[model samples]
Target chain A: MKDWRYWLAEQRGTLLAFGIFIVMFVIYTSNHPAGFTANVVQTAANKGVLLAFVAMAQTLVVITAGIDLSVGMIFLLTNCLASWLVVGTPMQTTLGVIAVLAVGLLCGAINGAIVIYGRLQPIVATIATGAVYYGIGLLLRPFPGGSVNEDLADAMTGRVFDVVPASLVVLLAIVLVIWVPFSRSVLGRAAYAAGSSETAAYMSGVPIRRGKFAAYTLAGLLAAIGGLFLTFFTYTGDAAYASGNAYTLFSIAAVVLGGVSLFGGKGSAIGAIFGALAFRTIGDLLFVFDFDPLWQPLFQGVILLVAVSLGAFALFRVRNRLEWFL
Target chain B: MSETTPMVGKSNGGIAGRMPKFIRRADPAVLTAFACIVLLLFLGSLYSRSFLSPEYLLQQLKVASFLGVIATGMMLVVLLGQIDLSVPWSVAAGAMMACAAAAYGPAGVVLAIPFGIFCGVLIGIVNGIGVAYLRIPSMIITLATNAVAQGLMVVYTGGFSPQDSATGAMRYLATGFAIPGVPNAVIIWALIGAAMVFVLTRTGFGRTVYGIGNRERAAYLSGIDTRRVVMIAFAVSGGLSAFGGVLLAGYASKAAQSMGDAYLLPSIAAVVLGGTSILGGRGSYLGTVAGVILITLLQSILSVMQMPEAGRQIIYGVVIVAMLLLYGRAPASR
Candidate 1:
């Protein structure tokens, strides 16, 4: 009984997700009147993988009660930069990927140093930096025009074993390499403690400053990963690859739905991945419904608010002890 | 009140030290921003000899008036230690409503003022209710309002620029010139700024705004109506934004559905740059004044130089970051 309680406590997000998955399975079966196909699953997984990387980046900073509005801008910039960097050059495509990741780290470091040294609140600081990053993208390509290397693009977008996408493999590698170590490490544990209560953590000898610096830096790097993945999805880049402003909401929406409290501390990487999948699936479902495409922005806002509100309500009830069931 | 005495020092140490302790803090944001404006002007003049003309400057000030007036209300909202993200939408709504009213001539124009004020109040109330009672964060509620505004504007105008007008006396607002040194709207904006300064310093409502902003729980405990104070703060912000929108309807000779979208970032930037706390209460109206000028001047300089939008945005971001480094830090925790 004790072990069961402990498992439930640690895996609440996963359990809630499983329950959702069951409901979704029943709904899809009834709607399609056929069992889920491999093709359908592959499509869902592909979209989920793209959003998952972005969501992971969002979760890292969000768990600290800070926001990185620049994530989308950084993604936009990196996608275009990657496309431009390896265009027709005999540069080892692998080396190009490494260089792109390095850029991501550098971008992340800039944000980390700004917040740590400049003492700007994460939201305001990021908003300003986002504009700058977008500007840099515009300079890279004044108009929206560029092509990706066909070979590399195919490797990323095409399936590895005809069942799993190459992009998915890279995304998994990221989760395995970065998110797993982060979730299990002692430093990761201290980061959680620091976020939970800065003063208490400081008193308990946790390095709050260092943890925040590392967290933001990782977020920046993850944003770069999101940008790289985007190049696979999109073969071209211009200044307007994606609306950077959207990141302010998408990242937030994913993490909040994934069960990370905006107030900081206590969340999971797997939960973030699920949340991103759910978010992307909703968008896909909207496409299936074939509503006016312009309704997308409004739909996104409503869905975001609904998802966030549900989380907020759950949090509020838990915090206020408002449960009334007999 | 005692806590804010230190804020005065944080903003302008000389004023705090030389003046009476009871003297309020001038917004350091305003001073720094003004310096930035002056520096930009000198650079502009140096780069292009013809940039310093009164006519050219008046044109710039006219553009600035739109943001400056709304920023007055934004200052009050920030003084209460909260944000109103709905300003962009509210401004858009006011412009559309005012433009619609202005179509009927003077009667419609006069009617537009109250109607505009009403819209602002309604939006403010909705925002306040969501934030205060429902306990949705102000950022989220106002952001949602922005989305609603975007949707509504698209529906109202059919995604096209609506014909409002500056054909009558309202044209004076858009293109009215006074002395060689001032545009009519700039003078009005200045008056509004002065009024804001007076309100923040002299009025009980203003002090309560600061009180609620600085410490909401303490303010409520001390018999201040903190929620009411916050509601009124949003209301004022909305009304002022509407006022700016009305003038805008006059200035542009018509209201475009998206005219207000650009004002939100700059207005909020002006407020923050002026040294008002993002959290609320300890700040200066003067600082916001500087913020408005700096932002306006930057836009003008960039426009004259024909910097691409991306590059301009980059510069704006960099300058803001630099300012944060200079003065935007939250005071080291005691």
Candidate 2:
């Protein structure tokens, strides 16, 4: 294949997700009562960024061919922790932010240790850790009331210079500061190699364990960022079990919709961002159409089903039955 | 190539052949689970005098019966080296649909039980098609179906709480005893357990499921309809999960939103606890029964001790991880 063709193939998933997001946003804005005002866009951006952050976290672990079921719980845990700590004086809030992030990193590291060293399957191992994380979150916030630093929360969640959503700007900064460098690093390549074919990667002398550990640890950090954003938006912490589970499930859906292979070894966090944005738009679309709010869940489910089925078309091209296993 | 062949053969014989027949034949995981069950029961007896009473034991078994039904489906899917994350909603869909059916007059009342199970089977078929024909991962597809199921239920109930009650027959099947002293739920679980054992041991379909799990390529090459087996396993799993939901609703005499939520992880945990490889292919029905009982007792003991929800969750997670570390490890390979 030509160089440009190869590049296009590599970026196809991201492009498709971007296209989907753009289309959905356009449709949503055109039908809205407010007609795509700055305030309307700001509200939508704020809602979308939460899932976008969680989906990005999911993308990292998924690139290593491992699933992290605990991202949502970590998001909840850090949000609860932040609601308590990210308050008081400016100095105290800064220290609290660092602590929350550190705890998130610790949670991710523990998951990595169990999966890599303890040799447990990723799915089952993460499920166990997820429960523990949620328990801690529940312990921290038995009820839904805690305060955050109001000034910091407002600046983080409000529009930047009355034009762009501040949350979107932070999300972009994170992608640049974390994702770009990580993807270009040696560990990222090793993680990808392992996901594609572990035995081959090992034979080729890949640092599979360290690479995966980095992916998982970074995933925790990203989820913590999401949790911090949640605290900013809500200004209180609630250890709601249903919502935690919903976020976990929705992140997976977002990742897949972004064209990241659940089987692993492909796709980008950028794509996942768009996927998350598009998914959030589903709820908005229903509102614009004046449908009952009850239609939101079904519509989201149908959209996910269709997006996922689109990926399955490749199966038809396989001539040999054995290739299906591969 | 010739020298390597003998080396491989010698290594296998030197290690495996030396083990005693009894040790080689038995499943250590299942035995360990049973031992834990005994330990839990003994621990519980210390909390209250009635803990060891026949009445208490039977009550625990009755509670376990709900999980037992769900785990049976989970095991079947696991045996195919696939998972069905849609169980929670499949269960809810079944219960809600059955209860809804009952509200449609006398004819609907008679069909409620079958109708509930059939809703689950339909969900399974959808899952099977995705995993089998479309080649979507079972994890993702099932997750989607679960969302879809949840959405459908929400729309059906109009986001308000469901008002349908379990039918008279449904209630009887769950709580009433056909045989004296034995609860009807336990008897139903026993029948399902017996059928599962027979199906897994004596049937060609069972062999095919194991074959697909071990190596789908080999199974396909051997002319087995691997896709069909996979589809059937999912369908069966869906049906069983729904049945569990139905029984749960019957026990309570009414259906509730998200009623099946409590069963999903416990069912998966129970199957795993019973020595069923989460990777699929090797397990026994008896182990599942033991796992179900053990989990029920453990929960009872924790509640009796008045542990907080947070503590209970932490312990539940820790126990699963500890047990997994015990015998669920995959054999080392290059």
Candidate 3:
């Protein structure tokens, strides 16, 4: 194959996800009464960014062929912590943000440690740790009330020059600052190798454990960032159990839609970000069409089922049945 | 783990005859879980005199029956090296549908339970097709179906709290005693448990489930219809989850939105705690029984101590991790 053809194959999932996002956004905005105005775009950007961050977190682990069930709880935990801490002087707010991020890193590290060293499966280990994170969050905000610095919240959530959403800029900056470096680094390659085939990766002497650990730890940091944004959006911390579970579940869906194989060893967070945006637009699509609010969940569910089923069409072409397990 | 393997093997040999043969041969995790149950009861008695009473223990067992039933289905899926994340909604769908059916008068009441289980089976079959035929990961497909089930229920109920109540028969099966000194729930659980044990040990379907779990490709090469086994396992999981929901609605006298939410993790926890491998293939029904009792007693004791929900959650997580650390470790492939 030509170099560009190889490149296209490599970037197929990401490009597909981006295309889906653009199509959905166009459909959503065209049907809206505001007709793609900046205000409408800003509102959608702010909502889409939350899941984007969580999905990115999920992408990191998924690349390592592992899943993090606690990302949502960590998001909630950091949100609750920020509500208590991300206040007062600007200097104090910075410290609080650092503290929350540190805690998020710690949570991810614990999950990594348990999975790598304790040898427990990622699914159950994260589920247990997720409960712990959620428990702490509940203790912090039992009744769903905590304040964020309005000035910071407004500035971060607002648009720049009345065109580009500030949150989108930050999302881009994060992609460059965190994702770009990580994906290019040796550790990232090891993570991919591990996900693709752990036995082969191990035989090749790849740093599988360290790579997986970094993926998991970075996932926590990303989820904490998501939680920080959530506090900014809601202006308070709420330890809603259902919401946490929903976010966790949605992130998985978004990651899959983004073309990240749940089987592990493929895809990018850029794809996941677009996947998240497209997923968020599903609810908006219903709103513009004048569906009953009660229909939102069912519509979202059906859309998800359809999007996920699309990924399965490849199985029909596989002549050998044994390959299905792979 | 490597170091202890030989030690355990040596102890089982004739040279080291100190430990009882039964103790040496039994699954250490199940024994440990039962020991924890006894310890928890002892701890509870210290907090309150009535903690050890037969009535209180029976009540705890009665409650555990619901979880026990749900975990039985979960164990089946897990044994197949897959999971069913749709349990929460499956449970809710079963309860809501059964209650909704009960509202249709006498015939509805008669068909409510079966209808509820049937709804769950439908959900499960969808999951099975996705996992078996479509080859989607069980984790993802079940999650999607869960959302679909949740949405369907919400639409069916119109976002309002469900208005239908459990029928007399439902209540009788869940709460009424068929034999003196034993609750109907306990009897039902025992019957289900007996059935599970028999099916797992005596049936070819059960053997195929274990074979597939251990290695699906190997099983398929061995002429097993691995897809059918997998699909059937998920279907049974959905049916049992709904049945558990039915009992819960009966216990509460009505079905509520999100009623199945609490059971999902606990059911998995119960099954895993009983020494079942989370990766699939190896486990026992008796071990699941021990796990169910342990978790139920742990909950009761924690409540008796007035432990806050936060503390309880933390403890629950810590205990699962700790137990997993003890015996749930996967073979060191990484």
Question: How well is each residue in A264-308 modelled by candidate 2, as lDDT tens digits?
Answer: 789999999999999899767889898898988898888878877
- Candidate order by lDDT, highest to lowest? 3, 2, 1
lDDT of 2 by residue, B242-296 (tens): 9998998899998877898777777878988998888887787878888899888
Question: How does residue A9 of candidate 1 score in lDDT?
Answer: 91
DockQ of each: 0.35, 0.62, 0.67
Cα error, residue A103 of model 2, in Å, equals 1.5
Please report the TM-score between candidate 3 and the true structure: 0.97
Cα RMSD for predicted model 1: 4.3
| Alpha carbon lDDT at B304, candidate 1 | 87
Range of the 10 consecutive residues with the lowest summed lDDT in candidate 1 chain A:
A317-326
- What local lDDT does model 3 show for residue A102? 97
Over A121-182, each residue of candidate 1 has an lDDT whose tens digit, in order, gives: 77678877887888888888786667777787777777767777676678778889998898
lDDT: which candidate is best? Answer: 3
Q: Which candidate comes out best when scored by TM-score?
A: 3
i-RMS for every candidate (Å) is: 5.4, 1.9, 1.9
- Tens digits of per-residue lDDT, candidate 3, A1-326, equal 89999989998999999998999999999999999899999999999999999999999999998999999999999999999999989999999989999999999999999998899999889999999999999999988888988899999999999899999999999999999999999999999998999999999999999999999999999999999999999999999998999899889879988988776899999999999998999778989999889998888888788877776454865788678764
Residue pairs that clash (backbone atoms under 3 angstroms), model 2:
none
Tell me what TM-score chain A of model 3 achieves: 0.97
